[model samples]
Target: MSDTGRDSSVSSPEALRSSPPVPGMFTMVLHTHLPWLAHHGRWPVGEEWLYQSWATSYLPLMRAFNTLAAEGRENLVTLGMTPVVTAQLDDPYCLTGMHHWLANWELRAREATTRTSGEDTGFAAPEAMRAFGIREREDAARALDDFAVGWRHGGSPLLRRLVDAGTIELLGGPLAHPFQPLLNPRLREFALREGLADANARFAHTPGGIWAPECAYAPGMEHDYAAAGVTHFMVDGPSLHGDTALGRPVTDSGVTAFGRDLQVSYRVWSPKSGYPGHAAYRDFHTYDHVTGLKPARVTGRNVPSQEKAPYDAERADHAVDVHVADFVDVVRRRLISESERIGRPAHVVAAFDTELFGHWWHEGPLWLERVLRALPAAGIRVGTLTDAITDGFVGDAVDLPPGSWGSGKDWQVWSGEQVADLVALNAEVVDTALATVDKALDQAASTGSWAPRDTVADQILRETLLTVSSDWPFMVSKDTAAEYARYRAHLHAHATREIAGALASGRREHAQRLADGWNHADGLFGALDARRLPR
Candidate 1:
């Protein structure tokens, strides 16, 4: 039966046995991703984004999960970390930088603490250091220490510990967050399979589901999703034609597509009027032009930083409480209303990028903490995607159309603006890299000399990864860091052209120059395994 027909029949509990006794359950999926940035660049563009995000988002959020799990809240959330991001997190260079960044963060906190303690009468008084605030700061410090220690001990091992301990439900994604709909079919398949394998090998867990980059989907992609052992994935609400279903496995393939119910999604963060825009939250767009950090309020026009009051911890806490209350109430209402209307408990799945919390929305981590704690108290039980699917409440197979969670819910974002040039460059690099790899393999077979192939293979692998990074197009489209995008695109393009030229002519001098340029540019993916290339 078609998805609509099946859902219609199952509208009432009497119509289908799949509907549960309640209205519906809800699960939250959060995506954690960033480009390969370690040792590439910093400050205005690259590694800074990774480090700041790790400081504000990853560490605090992971600490939240650890704390909740300690309180017996296992599997409170389902989180997907793309393999490329994971690889960087596990990289030695990244670990070293993080240790330095963590130390810097500690110094900042110590300074803040000292500054506050020295104050006498104002809001920043010495007595302002209350137990909760102290505990929060100390907890943040411990979280940073734990994270640094975890990385030293091995990021993959620490991640495995988190997963095995039930602190989180691990999720996967495509190789490099490709816009799969526009990619060549063979490349798309290879990207997905290799991505899944890489995730499995490093994390020690093979994901049964994935978060398609930008939630991009196309008809027949389901077959690939299923082939990669991805049992479920996310899609925008409109993409699913208003069918707010959870765990609905596709008919054409074994995979299921879960549509994000906009009702709940909009409550947390939306294009406008979301919780993130609340005056209490830290403003993301307008950073202090001097310090390169946020030191302003989202005040009404004409209000200067000096006039804006300090970050009112009380006001922020109150806003978090209200948002959490609203969320829990909404979830309960949806569950009750959907159950009454459909005659069985319906499931509501809300998904979002993990960066939204602390990186983009400064109070996001606090909001998440309150929301998780509030839901159960409000009688709205939370669930993870895997839990919902394994419990057997999913819709029948339905062929999904080509779509993405981009501008117009399509692939336009990656292909729009100056991004078009980057896209073309990416295509050229991929083609050249593949050709170079093939030629190198053939050379090794004929000359019985593996050294030449092995040496040139490094640049090929580097170009392949550079071509795959989603950042080039994303930065261009966002226009926040356009120059960086252009530089990366040109750098990758140069690498591709150089590799192809040297491989074609067997010119040792030219090849060495190209290798040196790649190294001098400090491209992070230069050290990747060439065997990852498709045969």
Candidate 2:
């Protein structure tokens, strides 16, 4: 069935009868994830994604959250920060790198004001480029100032503040954001347990919900969720076959699966059509390469990069107003129609990547703030995914289809023929690492309540976990930084094999040295213990 199938078999009349007399519930879920990017590589592909998304997406998104939060807005957006990404945001090296990256952004913006144009940059008019430069320089300075004041401690403190303030409902996911369905069952559970534990270490509470790593789901995965104490998680609309009037309890488990309301979501995110592609919005692709700043407007869809018009802030603001109003109307209509059709006020979730806000779509933060503010006034009740469940927008059990939010709504992107080697690598490394770690735990066993921490085994497990991250296969299949993705996977796998070998061979000194080296390079999740790896 298509995403808009509207099949009603999933929800019976009895479930909808008790729903409250509200128009509807709406939630904007931001799945904030960037693969573990610390010490792997730098520009063009690696940690650069982390820093750019930090500056453009995270910082501005936080600003919006803080501003709305100050106004006493609660349950605004359910934000998911993957444990791997959160680790980097809290990592010391990453903090320092971000500080420098912010400074460089400022310098680059200032440079745009004075630099001469080459053949590539010649498309940028002098005055227009200077205006863009001046604006960017000011924004960069403000970002740097925000970083100095609010982010100096790292992402944990910032996220903790949001959590404490009760402005956002946080969602946690597995460490490294692995595709859980394809993972070894023991390793899968281990990663998720540690991932939520990692969340507790920072946020002081394990999130009741998760983003489910690409919204990927398998038949029995809900059992794992129930075991993990998760109340809810997200999947794409098609997974529920568009009978998403309410959250569905998966297989009689208490865990609820909220399907994305694609009708409302695609209004802003669709490739064929969306607000960001509007002509007045700043063009995301065309750039003034001289200073690495984009100075063009998306004049038309088919327009060439050089031929695109110069960006106008006022024009973009006007376009945002128009789009915001359009979205509010869309939500209003969807709520009314769905409620009437389903015999109750329905639940709608529009989940998107958090990075799309400021990093990919330059004017996205402004649009987000405007639309969020406009929703309640337009008579729509907006809340987090948990709030939707609490509001009684829930239905009968669903034997959810195996699916993902990726291309074709299947696992092929992460487990396909083109990446067959990577799939094999993941299976091999997990088996070897698990067997080796189990043996090491036996060697390091203790009579006390706590098993002594095994740095060597922990390092081996760490590398093994990193090697199986979904990002490598996704990148390889998508051809976006395919080389770097493959390299990272192999690098971690190699580290895992070498360390596991040294420890298994009883070369204690050699294993310790290898553990020390890899830990410095990939020392995320400081709380990881070898004893925790066994099923």
Candidate 3:
């Protein structure tokens, strides 16, 4: 580990204030990701996930970024748009379905207002329901209008505008958000390359940074990253074994790994405590079953769902103000201490999932906007990871240990006894898919009749990639919709096997049928060509 030389001379507050300002940099990284959910299922666990997140999180976040950009706030944060999530956002099915979902949300909110007194049996009282309904109705209306104006041509236009305006530094990742540490090396490289290509094709700008799905890594992966043209990526703070206050270049590689600042980041979100748990914020778990909207506040952790108080926007806004100030103080104090300790400026990188704002925590977006504005006014420098590097925050090279952001900061969440079956299944599916595709390509080349690109081969790769998504094992470990996650995983695995079997048996007609059926159901990556797979 490299020593951050400590300077004890500038100890007093007055001296610190009088001295030239240390080049303290603050960068917020938001990882936006979701598995390929389009055309899979619709109601409880499938496409609805896409539409709900799009309306509540993606739309509102874009609006927030645009607002800041309009005020000349450049490089406010780093936004990661995984290729799989981007694909769904730009899919015609998802776009149309989202519009329809928003329209229905408005109707549902309107209906809630007129429900009979006895029918309002949710945690919120009738009057509270009416208030919540009206607010939701207006929100849905605004979102619908925004969608029509900005997202009709898919999210690419809106996202491109953000990048072009310098509002955010976009980060791209693997095509399917596969757990790269466990993936076959050939497929891993292929996914990374294709993912970058997808982002360039959509945004007309290639990202120099990547999110490194789940921050999961094994030794030597840095070589793969450098080869794929990635200059920087993120890993959990503990991956550095506690020396995570600054970005560090991997051993001998130009690529840098920025570690998440757990102290600052966990102030807003953590497994045990965070701003979202405030008494006045809307409770994510409790909901009004009638309208499928959350209508209660988290009165207390021990309080039963039925005993929670009805959510009040006024109270939540007050909480946002309080937490925002507290967060700003935390950042300020951290920078001062670290700068003094390192004898120079320090960089603080706080990262979180993008869905935490607006989707999981209703007041999160408001808190974000307030924090962005407050930090600059308080003399705190805010910038993206690129800006931090330019400001000289890079440290000496270190070999990172094998780990992820999961519990215990190890691979157990992905490869534990609880998910051993999934691990085995993934290994089998990926190996079979690769062998099948290579064989098919070789046979086609020798015959010289048809092109090497086979629909069956394409579908096999698609399903195989889908099977390898990290979400299934995570959901299973967390027990949050584990059944649905398993169903999705197995469904794709079965499809891969069926398609590969048909192709291997020389049953072209049967293989085509399987390809068409799977394509109609799980298609999102229209640009994926199996011929690109390494032979």
Which digits, one per residue and each the tens of the lDDT, describe model 3 over residues 456-501? 8888888888999999999999998899999989999999999999
Clashing pairs in 1: 11-342, 13-343, 22-345, 23-345, 23-346, 24-346, 249-256, 250-397, 251-397, 251-398
**TM-score, prediction 2:** 0.94
lDDT of each prediction vs. the true structure? Answer: 0.70, 0.86, 0.86
Q: Candidate 3: where are CA atoms >4 Å away?
A: 1-22, 115-118, 447-452
Worst 10 residues of 3 by lDDT: 1-10
- Judge candidate 2 against the unseen true structure and give its global Cα lDDT, from 0 to 1: 0.86
Model 1, which residues run further than 4 Å from truth? 1-22, 108-144, 285-306, 443-455, 508-535
Q: Give the per-residue lDDT digits (tens) of candidate 1, residues 500-529.
A: 788678885788677767755654433345
Count of backbone clashes for each model?
10, 0, 0
Off by over 4 Å in 2: 1-22, 115-120, 446-450
Each prediction's RMSD to truth: 7.2, 5.7, 5.2
> What tens-digit string does per-residue lDDT give for candidate 2 at 504-526?
89898999999999998778988
